[model samples]
Target: MFTLDQTLARDCAVVGDLPLCRLLLMNDSQYPWLILVPRQDGLREICQLDDDQQAKLMNESNLVSHILLQEFGAEKLNVAALGNMVPQLHLHHIARYAGDPAWPKPVWGALPPKPYSADALEERLARLQRSLAAVGSPLSFPA
Candidate 1:
């Protein structure tokens, strides 16, 4: 069986499930961020995924990059799969801007997380769901 890392569950909102990943939106409202975790059991590294799985993940990553660039108009998109804190086969997709607080730097530890308020979180979730729908993929989101 597979379960999301507790740390991730605490820090992110359930966005939806893609073909092979569980999409999550980071709780922070400062910058646009998303995470994708393979829905596989006991996997901590991308190398653990077979070639086909790897390719699928890459395609999904590209989909997210496209959303950030086209829908949000992000200046730069940062994609990483650092499992230092939570050793899950998860990837991070962050949207960066020139004058943002952590410009030219990473989003981690640059500033404390500003969790989205109830209204903000709702709006964010709705916008992201719409974005995914616009992509025409049959993503299944939480009720």
Candidate 2:
């Protein structure tokens, strides 16, 4: 059985799921940030996954990075799997621009998160759902 960490659940909106990961959208409206959390229980590091699972995670991570660059036109994409606080095996994909507030620094603790407005959140979720669903195979979206 698997459950999302409380901190992650509280900070992100459910985007959908992939074959091996539960996709989440970080609620911060400041940038296009997404998270991929593997659905296995008690996993705290990427090395914990078998080779096949590791391959799948990379494929999904690439898919998200591609979309962020192609669709969102991110100048640079910051992808990381840091679990210092949550201790879950989750990858973060953040679309970055040179002029962003965090700029040359890590997004964390740089500035307070600006959550999306009701309509903005809805639209953003819909857009991401469409983008992910459009890429068929190895990807799944909840109805």
Candidate 3:
């Protein structure tokens, strides 16, 4: 019943899944960005989820944020749930550094996305998969 939006699927690589969300890694090599999309249909906002689902989403979001920060030594962790272009309830967790290209400003629309090359993408995915596997919680990596 849950299907990913075309734009999201095209732009991100499947990292894995949590109990309630599908984890995706944005292909852009600029920043370590992860997206958590709830596995539900016709859900366009976080408020649409019940209290329990909301709590689970929050937990998963925090886990991804912390992972990004700790693994990347990020100066800041930015989390947002914006569905302006794609009407799916997806939360973005981006690791930010003080000297990053989009420092002092949001990553969106600041500069063009520098997508990872084939080898780089595969390596990044493997690294993320390993990281997610170590979390050892509600987070589940696909076989």
Candidate 4:
């Protein structure tokens, strides 16, 4: 059975599930970041996905990138699937702004992760859900 990596489970909010991937919201409040993890066990690279699965992952990732950019008025969308630490098949889509703390640099290790407050987390998740809904995504979010 598929399971989330311990670090991921501890650090992210379960936003929902698509047919083949679980949508996750990174808890860091600094940026609008989301992750998509394929619900397949022991897969640590995108190349491991079969052709159809690879296509689906890209499609989903693009959909998420566009939504985040619009919702956050991002100056750029940073999409990546680097699993150097966790070794899980997960894609990250981060919305970046020119004036953000990280600015021209990558978000990682720019500063310590600032977790969202309970109320803020809830609100951010709602906004993400609404964005997904607006795009007519079929994923089902937690109530």
Off by over 4 Å in 3: 138-143
What's the lDDT for candidate 4? Answer: 0.90
lDDT (10s digit) by residue, model 1, range 37-137 = 99997898889999999998999899888988887789999999999989888999999999888889899999999999999999998898899999896
On lDDT, the stronger of 2 and 3 is: 2
Stretch of 10 with least lDDT, candidate 4: 134-143
lDDT of each model, Cα atoms only? 0.91, 0.91, 0.89, 0.90
lDDT of 2 at 27: 94
Please give each candidate's TM-score. 0.96, 0.95, 0.94, 0.95
Task: Rank all candidate structures by their lDDT, best first, as comma-separated numbers.
Answer: 2, 1, 4, 3
Candidate 3's residue-wise lDDT over 1-143, tens digit each?
Answer: 78999999999999878899999999899999999999998999999999999999999888888789878888899899888989898999999988899998999999899999999999998888777778775556655
- By TM-score: ranked, best first: 1, 4, 2, 3
Error of 4 at 68 (Å): 0.9
Which prediction has more favorable lDDT, 2 or 4?
A: 2
Model 1 lowest lDDT segment of ten = 134-143
Q: Write model 4 residue lDDT over 108-140, tens digit each, in one string.
A: 889888999999999998888888888899887
